[model samples]
Target: MSSLHTLLVIASLVIGGMAGMLYQKRRNEAENIKLNKTAEDIMSRARKEADEIVKEGKLESKDLVYKGKQELDREVKEKKKELSQQEKRLIQKEEAIDNKMSSIEKKEEQVARKNQEAEDKLKSVDKVREEAENLRNNMINEIEKIATMTREEAKQLLVSELLEDAKIEAARELREIEEQTKSEADKKARSIIATAVQRCAPEYVGEISVSVVNLPNDEMKGRIIGREGRNIRTFESVTGVDIIVDDTPEAVILSSYDPYRREIAKMTLERLITDGRIHPARIEELQDKCKQELDKHVLEVGEQTLFDLGVHGVHKEITKLIGRLKYRTSYGQNVLGHSIEVARICGTMAAELGLNEKIAKRAGLLHDIGKAIDYESEGSHTEIGLEVAKKYKEDWRVLNAIASHHGEEEFKCVESVLVQSADAISASRPGARREVLESYLKRLENLEEIANSFDGVSKCYAIQAGREVRIVVEPDKVNDERLVTLSKDISKKIEEELTYPGQIRVTVIREARSVGYAK
Candidate 1:
């Protein structure tokens, strides 16, 4: 029984096992089918989403391509418009160039036509000139034959006549030129000279070789002569001046050839007389002191003269020499006074003529410097002055003025000429020189004789103290045109024949009178 029960149990266990297997298998199959369906749904959804994304991408791409094409078309249109404008400008420039070329060609053709016309006119003119020249030559030959003279002789006669006519015409032209020049120059020159003369008015003193010192009494004269003339001897020995205690009242005369010594002697004697100590020792002491004072006074005068002249940078020796001029005399005029007057006149004229007044004045002042020592010097004042000036390293212009003021040398500068002119004006003024009546009259006669010697002069008169000659010209012989030449001739003759101071003015008067009665 137990074995049978065990077998049934085993069979039941087997069937249950098979049933559990089938149940597990069916569950696994259902799970697999559900998993398959889920996969299919997910794949379908993914494909739909991908298709929509592709369609949207295609639309965006198409829109971008359209925008790009529209932008490209706008740029291409702008390029075409710019190219059209450039083509129009090029066409206008080509038209302008063509017009300019046509105008230039027309002008060139016109020039060529004018050139051809000018050439034709030149040919006609050459033919006419040749015909005229031949006619003139024929006329000349006929004239020579009719005159019964050779061609050379006829030519010579004609040339002589032409030369004579030309001389007259040249003379007329020269006179006109001279008149014009004189008319212009005379006005200014006269003004300058007149002004200079009017401005300079120096005092004229008749300086003599002797100086008179008035004594207190006749008793003072004897004191000056002292005992045995010891005081007078010492004074003359030291001062080199002769003291003349004469019978001319209470005055004693100091005589000396050297003005410097005379002046010092005068001062020394005057001081000795005032002090009442007229002795040999006192006389000499006073003389030496007076000499030193006079020397110092000379320097003062020099410095004062330069200061008055507004001159500077003068050498001391030159200044001393200038002071010495105060004691020196030329003719009857004081050399210092004459020099100062010359300086003033020169300065005035120089100012008017627009030159350096300082240089002119300096030259004038130093012009007669040698006259200061001319008594002691071996040469003329000009030579001595020139040597001194060269030694002092004066200006070359100044040196020339010093050398040539007396007309010994040629002038090197305008200022030198002015210096000479000033010197002449000073030396030639009225009462400047001591001329005898005989010589003065002789000079006037000589001047008139010189003027009358000219052929065309009808009458002449020397006036203004021989400074000017006025001539009456024969109108027939010397026409108004020839008067200038005649006057110049007379003046040249006067210059060549006579020796006169300053300048002589020649005045030629030509008068033509035709009188008719109205009744």
Candidate 2:
């Protein structure tokens, strides 16, 4: 029984220990439950946080997608806008070009309309003119019919009479033309001659063959001879004047072509003889004295010429120069005298014709003034005279006359032409002047050249100082038709080619004389 009891106490002790351990374990388990609760709450919180994170991620994703879509839409709109603007610009450019084209087409249409209008007007006018012409012809026909028979018959009868009248009218027309031309030519010629003759007056040239050098006595001849003619030889060589020591007592002869030089030499010899000197120095002295005397005489002569000419307003220097004209000759006529005659004629003619006498007179005076110094001037006499007149304060018209007097220039004024005519008249008068042999031959040669230019012309001769050109045509070659043509042609050619005093009559003859055999 004791053993059983110990066993039961041991069991109870063991139970008590087990029960305490169980209680402790239960408490620990409750603490563990609370800890588990806390753990669960932490886990729930973590789950919620995770859920919130997912929601936040979804929201961000949605926002990003929306922003991307919006950006995509905005890009589409920008592209559309650009395209629209480009299309609009293209339309605008096309419209502008179309507008320009339309404007150009309108302008072209307007021009065409104007051209059509002008053409229509011209056609209308042409129709009116045609109608007028027709009406005129019809009127002429009706008027003829009213006179008597049929229109053609009456017109023919009237036309026959009219044709006869027209023949006479034609003849009168040509005759009237001839008369008018002649009258005009005469008037022009008269005008020219009148002007030239009025202005100039010149000294006439006289024959002076012998120039006398009077000696004081017969004893002076011995001094002049110098015992061997040495003085005479020296004098002749120095002066170019022939010293004729002759038996005619107390007088010596001076001969030379140049009359001024002869006079100078004569004066020189007279001075030497009077001075009674025989040396070369004395000869020179006498020559100088003679030259001085000649100068004075020349001036005196010029003054005298001016007085004789009735010319005034000349410079003294010019007057002195004009004095030299007394020694000058043109075609063997005294140039000074010719000038004077021309001046007088021009003056007289101008007075009669009621023209400018002063201009005429001036022109006539200076017309031949160039010849005075023409050799020294080295130009045409007309040109020289022109220059001289210009220098002498002459009128421009007078200068023109001086130049045109020789056809050196075209005559500007009537006075210029007048001067030329008077000069021609004065020169052309019988024995007015002489022509050189060479000139005569050359004139004949020119005549031949002129005649030979004509077809079938055989020969030509210039006679009476080119006053006539006789043309002989070959009878076999020149027909009557050709003869008339040749005559007209020759006359026209002569008129163009020749410069002479008077109108040259071109005589063209065509003789058809056959040389038959004697048998």
Candidate 3:
């Protein structure tokens, strides 16, 4: 009984569970059908909306195409209208050209007719002229036969007489003109030169290649000589100067060809003497210090020169070179003093002559700059000066003055002329330069020789310290006309062959005497 009950209960539970499963499956199937219907409806609506959107897009595209075509057509019509207007203008221009061509052709025909008429008139005139020329020639031949001279001979005789008369008149006029002009020119030149000299009175100190330094005692000399002369040798080698310590009481001589080197040695010796420390190392140290001091001194000197001249804008190197002139000498005259004198003279003369005084003075101050470096340079002072001026980009007028101050170049302006005259005045002043006896004698001899070399010169005398040469010419050999020419020739020969300062005045004397005895 208990097993039957248990079996029946299990069978019931199984059947009930199967029924519940079938119910759950039926509910799931109904839910799946509902989800499928809802999905199908959503897909149908989406398709309808998409179809409508595509139709709208097609319609919009067709409208845009139609509008674009219409705009294109309108543009084409406008272009056609513009082209037709241009064509009309071209047709009008062509018609106008045709009319101009017709007018030009008519004018050409008229010009051709006129040209023909002119040719005929020219031909007739030529015939008449030929006939007249023949008649004239016949008349000339008749006249020549009667006169017993050809036309050319008559012309030559007339020309000869006219030439002789002209020469006499020309000579008389030239003599009078020269006498008048020379008198005025000489007076003016004297006045200018005298004024320039009077205004500028520069003090000059003669410089030599030896510098003497006074010592406290002779013991200092021995000390300067140092052990084994090492100190002296080192100083000399460094300074490029020789120290001559002889029995000169209490003085030592620093000798060198270069004034700058001599100066350096002098300074170095003075410092070493004062410090009382004499050795190679001390000597070099003091030498370096002295060089620095000298450089400062050089720059100060340059600045002072420029300030004195009232010049500005000089290159640094040029200013240094100018200062170097302070230690330079020419013919025993201080170059700096001479240059200052020249600058003053140039300024004065320029003021008097209505020229640029500053430019004149500037050129005058720098004219001898070449002499500063002439020892190291290969050319003449003028050439070196020209190069220096060019290097510094100096004014062209200043360059001209520098180059032509020695007459090495042609004067380019009145300022150059003024600078040249100033230089001459400064260099040629009394006591400005010292010429050795030998050179002076040689120069005088050369002057006389040059004068005597020319023909018609009977005798010549170089007077006024060779500043002037008076030549006696043979009156038979040189006439009054040739006297002027002979003087010029002798002057030219002197200029070309001789080298001298200042200028040479050539005077040719031709005197004719008729000797007669009244008995």
Tens digits of per-residue lDDT for model 3, 435-479: 667888899999998888888889999886677799999999898
Which residue pairs show collisions in model 3?
A: none
Better of 2 and 3 by TM-score: 3
Q: Of models 1 and 3, which has the larger TM-score?
A: 3
Tens-digit lDDT track of model 2 for 142-205:
8866865676787788899999999999999999999999999889766655454444444334
For residue 54, what is the lDDT in candidate 3?
96
Model 1 spans > 4 angstroms off: 1-171, 433-519
TM-score of 3: 0.62
What TM-score does each of the candidates earn?
Answer: 0.58, 0.49, 0.62
- Indicate whether candidate 1 or candidate 2 has the larger TM-score: 1
Off by over 4 Å in 2: 1-175, 181-222, 225-230, 233-255, 434-519
lDDT accuracy of residue 327 in candidate 1: 92
Worst ten in a row by lDDT for model 2: 197-206
Model 1 residue 464 distance off true place after TM-score fit, in angstroms: 7.2
How does candidate 2 score on lDDT?
Answer: 0.77
TM-score of model 1 vs. true structure: 0.58
